[model samples]
Target: MTVAPGPADHAELQRQLPGLGQAPGPVDAAVPAAHALLVHPRARQAIVLGGLNIGYELVRVRRRSIGMVVTAEGLSVRAPRWVGLGDIEAALQAKARWLLGKLGEQGERQRRLAAGRIDWVDGACLPYLGETLVLRLDPQQRGLALREAAAGDTPPGRRLLLGLPPQADAVQVRDAVQSWLMKEARRVFLERLAHYAPTLGVQVRRLALSSAQTRWGSASADGSIRLNWRLIHFSLATLDYVVVHELAHLRHMDHSPRFWDVVRDVLPDFDQARAALRDPVLPAFD
Candidate 1:
């Protein structure tokens, strides 16, 4: 099974995966019970063809057969302009079993992603280098700082003192924290790059921070590396996987066997570090 990003809105989702959209099955009553209606804003027709209570977005396009795409926004169907509403409903009935299963998976994924979004206000907490850090609004603080929080004799977590107002809105708090995170990303990225470059027998010409939406990091044919600033949200081990990954590309451009060999040579536990990236649900920026 594969997971995809949640839809931006009711109508912003597009088909990405190839075979995930094509499901062949006879209608079954095993569809899970849905709690609420999931409707696309632009839907022309609605139906409860399957046991699932969600309504699919029926769209008429220039096509010969009906096509179904399950997105984070629910179900969307594309059919020939000539296809009648009855025929479209019948098509959904035929693929009900497969459709319901995929929708359930996507719905759960979206819920987790939604929960992971940061509120970005005073007292909001977030993960830094695999540890919990409470966000404290400190407008008088001269710079971004971290202080240990001790409750009695036991320390439960750390506090990140940001230079922001106590009544700062979400946007203001988000900007201040993000700016500090990017700076730390740059400083940490260079340190790891320098640590592994000589051992990997590679010379890194330059290192830069990237804010790419989908990519973690990239290695160009040139000896430059670009790592996402968001990586600072994860652990040092998780961040090193991407850093060492891009550095390994300096030796092998493609993901051939030689590439894994190079990555394993330095970061012996690289696979474990790579898995950490997915185990944690990152804070949503927007």
Candidate 2:
């Protein structure tokens, strides 16, 4: 249970715990009184209640919102400062069905992510830039490296080699690959931003990677852009499209037609990338 400091932090707090601060007011008195608590499949015991509302408590510090968040650590709820303990319990009880459903979905997502683990050995299939890349390890190769070869470029009777150290484990391989992809993503994203900035006549002040589960990306009025690092799993074209989408927001804060027009002007085929981004599999990573 954490409390945010100062009035300025209220908005930030509210964003985390949706409906806690600016909630639609209490449910009708006839909604029935009940006690509710967060139960995480990963937790050893049920989390104790802290506030009066239908909200769950989230424990992650970097998690800025107060609403429910499903994580490896467990379920968390962000309660508003003025909420009463009884009211919170009642709200949780009333919303038990919704919370349970969310928990199940999150649990499944976590399972899938764990299931997708790579063996880091020869013949492992890994996702790369929206496509699956097969690893072909060569023990004879002297050092660690990644080599991209055309599917058919291999010798008539020989397979292409993807040089990964023999001693590397799954976790190490995943990290190495992710680091390479992120570096490339940053480079390509910055280049695309620069390319479109001049055309849109806007300058980006800051850019950072985001791990947000609910949003693919977000842009602030202050010219800051936050893009999901998982986006590197998609194609370069799709990544560029998201960048353009956020950059356009600098000119038009809302998703109005004018804002879309700005995106279209820069990326005429933005629809393809948009469709690709809608893949339900992309959000599997929590």
**Clashes in each model (backbone N, CA, C under 3 Å)?**
0, 19
* Candidate 1 per-residue lDDT over residues 1-286, each given as its tens digit: 2223234311221222222233434456566644343565566666655544566787767554568998878889997665456656666766666776777777677777877988888888887778888888888987779899967623357988988788888997888788888898899899999998899889999888898877899998889899999899888988988988999999899999999999998888887888877645788777
In order, candidate lDDTs are 0.76, 0.62
Residue 175, candidate 1: Cα error in Å is: 1.2
Cα displacement (angstroms), candidate 1, residue 99, comes to 1.3
The numbered model that scores best in lDDT is: 1
For model 2, residues 194-265, the per-residue Cα lDDT tens digits are 888888888999989877777778999999998887887788888889988998999999999999889999
Segments of candidate 1 deviating more than 4 angstroms: 1-37, 152-156, 278-280
Please give each candidate's TM-score. 0.81, 0.52
At residue 71, candidate 1 shows an lDDT of 80
